[model samples]
Target: MSYKNILVTGGCGFIGSHFIHHLLKKYKDINLVNVDLLTYCGNPENVRDIADDSRYNFYKADIGDYNAMSSVLKKHQIDCIVNFAAESDNNKAVSSPVDFARTNALGTAVLLEAARQAGVKRFHHISTCEVFGQLPLKSKSKFSEKSPYNPRTPYNAAKASGDLIAKAYHHTFGLPVTISYCANNYGTHQFPEKVIPVFAIRAIQNDPLPVFKSSGNKREWIHVSDHCSAIDLVLEKGRAGETYNVGTGLEKTVTNIADDVLAILKKPKTLKKIVPDRPGHDSRYLLDSSKMKKLGWKPKIKWHEGLEETLNWYKNNPKWWQPLLSRSNSWK
Candidate 1:
C-alpha cells in the first residue's frame, strides 16, 4: 500500500508528537497534517525538528469543530486519520468534565464523521488502558481487547464513550476504523502534569513528590517511542474494525515508579509523600499487548532505559518545561 498523506490529531502533545517524529523519519513519502488545539499539553516545540519539513503541516484548530475539520480533511487530501486528540489528565477531567466530554467524546465523533465523509482509507482511535477501569493488582489475568469497558474517571469515561462512537462508525458505516488501547505512556515531550514527568520535575527541583492514594496503585508503563512504533505498525499493517492493546508488560506500583525516578535522578526516596489520591483513581491498570505482538509488533524500549532517557531530556531541557511548570492552573 502506497500511503501518502496522513493526519495526526493532537500532534504536538506528548505521545502524538513522538508518533509524528517517528512516522516522518520512517516513511519518506508520507505527508503529515497535525491538527491540535494548543491546549495546555500541546506544545509545537515538541516537534521542532519537523516544523520546517515540507512534508509536515500543522493547524491550530479544535477537532470539535466539524466544518473546520471537514475543510482541513478536504484541503489536505488526507488518506488516514489518527485520532490522538483528547483531554487525558485525570485531575483536569475531574474539574472540567464538560471540557473532557467536548474534546474526547464529541470531538472524536466529529473526526469520524469527517473521515467518513472524506472517504479516508483508515481511521485509528488512540485510547488508554484506563478505559478498562481498575484491574486488581493481585489478579493473574491481564486485560485483553475483549475486556468490558468500565471507566472510573471522567477522563476515561469520555475516552470510553469515544471508543464506542468509533466502534459504531466502524460497524454501522464501515468506516474502516481500528482502535489501540495503550498502557500509561512515559517519555520525552510529555507535559509535567503526568506522573512520570511530574515526579521527574519535582525531583529535579528538590521538591516534595506527591504520592496519590497511598502510592499503592499499580500500572503498566510503556514508552512513548514504543507506543508510537506500535501505532505506526497498526496504521501500516493492522486490520480494520479491530482493537489492539499496546503495552510494555511492565506492571509496577506508584511507589516503585517514584523510587525508580528518584534513583534515576540520584535523589533520596525520602522526597516522596503519600498525598490524597484523586477521586475515582483506578487501583491498577494492566493490558495484554500480545495481540499486537502476534501481529509482528513488539515494544522495544525497556522502562529503566526509557525512564533514564526521559529524565535526561527534562534535565537538559529546562527552558521547555520551566514555562510549562509556571502555569499552575494547567498543571493542577
Candidate 2:
C-alpha cells in the first residue's frame, strides 16, 4: 500500500508513541497526525521530541466522538488509519465496563465508519492477546489467529468486540482493515501502572513490588519496539481482513520477570509481596506470532537487555513520572 499520510489514534500513549517515533524515523515523506484524549495514562510529553516536526500533528480529540474524528480525517486527508485508542486498564475496566465498551468497541466502530467514508486505503486496529482469555498451563499451547474468543476480563472483552467490528467492516463493507493481536508490551514511556514500569517505580521508591498470584502465572513478553515494527509491517504489507499475532515468543513466569527487574535495579528480589490475585486473573496466556515472523518481522531486543534499558529510562525520567506517580494509586 503506497501511503503518504497516516492517522494514529492514542499516539501519546505507550505503544502509539513508539509507533509514531518509528514511523517518523522510517518514512520522511509521510505526514502523521496523532489524535488522543490525553487521559491520565496518555502523556503528550512522551512525544515532545516530535511535536515540533513539520510532518507531525497532534489533535486533542477522542475517537469516541464521531464528528470530531470525522473532521480530523477529512482535514488531514489520512490515507492510512491505525486505531490504538482504548481504555486499557484492567482495574479501570473492572470498575467501569461501560467506559471500556464505549471506547474500545463503540469508538472503534465510529472510527471504522469515518475511515470508510474518508476512503482510507488501510485501516489497522491494534488488539491484545488477552482476548484469548486465560489458557491453561497444562494445555501447553499458544493462541493463533484462529483462536476462539474467550475474553475473561472486561478490558479484553471490549477489545474482542472491537476486533469483531473491524472484521465485520471488512466483510460487509469491503473496508480495507487489518487487525493485529499482540502480547504484553514493555518499554520506556509506559505509564507506571503497567507491570514492568509499576515495579520499577515502586522499586525506585523503596516500596514493595506487588505480586498478585503465586508468581507462576505465565505470559508472553515482547519489547515495545518489536511490537511497533510488527505493526509497521502489518500496516505496510499485511493482508486486509487478516489477523496477525505479534510477540517474541519468550514466555516467562510473572515471578521471574519481577525478579529480573530487581536484578536490573541492583535491588534484592526480597521486596516482592504476594497478594490475592485479581478477580478472574488468567493463569497463563501465550501467542503464536509466527505469522508476523513469516512477514519478515522479528524482535531485536532480548528480554534481559530490554528490561534493563526500560529500568534506566524510568530512573532518568523522574521529572516525567514524578507527578504521575504522586496521583496514581498503584504504589499505595
Candidate 3:
C-alpha cells in the first residue's frame, strides 16, 4: 500500500516526531501533514530539523474540533490518517480525567468520523498496554491482541475507549482502521515527565531521582525507533479492524531503570529517592508481540544500549528540555 498523502496527528510529540522523520526519509514522494494541538508535551522543536522540508506541512489544530479536522483532511486529500493526538500523561490524567476523555476518546471519535467522511484509506490508532491493567509480578500472563479491556487509570480508560471507538468505526461504518497497543517507549525528545527522560534529566543535573514506592513495579521497554518500525509495518500490511501489540518482550523494574541511568552518568546511587507511589500504580505490564512479529517486525535496539543512548541524549540536549521543565509543573 503506497500512500502519497498521510495525515499524522500529534506529530510534534516524541514518538510522533520520530515517526514523521522516519516516514519522510523512507518515502521520498510522500507528502506528510502534521496536525497538532501543541499541548504541553507537544514541541515543534522535536522535528525542527525537518521543518523546511517541502513534503512536510504542519497545522496547529485540535483533533476534537470536527470542523478543523475536516478542513485539514479535505484540503490535504489524505489517504492515510495516523491518530496520535491525546493527553497521555498518566499523572495528569489522574488529576484531569475530563481532559483525557475529551482528547483521547472524544477526539478519536471526531477523527474517525472525519476520516470516514473524507474516504481515507487507512486509519491507524496508537494505543498503550495499560488498557489491560496490571499483571501480577508472578503471573505468566502477557497482554495480547485479544486481551480484555481492564483499564485502571483515567489515561488507559480513555485510550481503551478510543481503541473501541476505532474498532466500532471499522465494524459499523466499514472504515479501514488498525489499532496498535505498544509497550513503554523510551528515546530522544521524550518529554521529561515520562519515567526514562525524567530520571535521565535529573541524574544529569545531579538531582535526586524519585523512585515510586519500592520501585519493584515493572514495565516492558521498547526503543522509539523500533516502535516506529513496527508502526510502519502495521500500516503497510496490517489488516483492517485488527489490533497488534508492539513490544520488545523486555521488562525492567523501575529501580533497575533508575540505577542504570545513574550508572550511565556516573552519578552516585544515593541520588535515588524512594517516593510514595502514584495512586493506582500498576505492578507490571507485559505484552506478547508475536502477532506483530509474524508480520516480520522485530525490535532492533537492545535495552542497555538504548538506555545509555537515551541518557546521553538528555545530557547533551539541555537546551531542548530545560525550558520545558520550567513551563510545566508536571515535570516533578
What C-alpha lDDT values do all the predictions have?
A: 0.89, 0.89, 0.92
Tens-place lDDT digits, model 2, residues 20-115? 999999998999999999987899998999988999999999898889988998999999998999989887777678989999999999999999
Q: Tell me the TM-score of model 2.
A: 0.98
Best by lDDT: 3
Question: What local lDDT score does residue 254 receive in model 1, on the 0 to 100 scale?
Answer: 89
* Residue ranges of candidate 3 with Cα displaced over 4 Å: none
The model with the greater TM-score, 1 or 3, is: 3
Error of 1 at 257 (Å): 1.0
What's model 1's overall lDDT?
Answer: 0.89
lDDT of 3 by residue, 165-221 (tens): 999999999999999999999999998888888898888888899899848889999
Ranking of all predicted structures according to TM-score, beginning with the best and ending with the worst: 3, 2, 1
| Runs with alpha carbons beyond 4 Å of true place in candidate 1 | 328-332
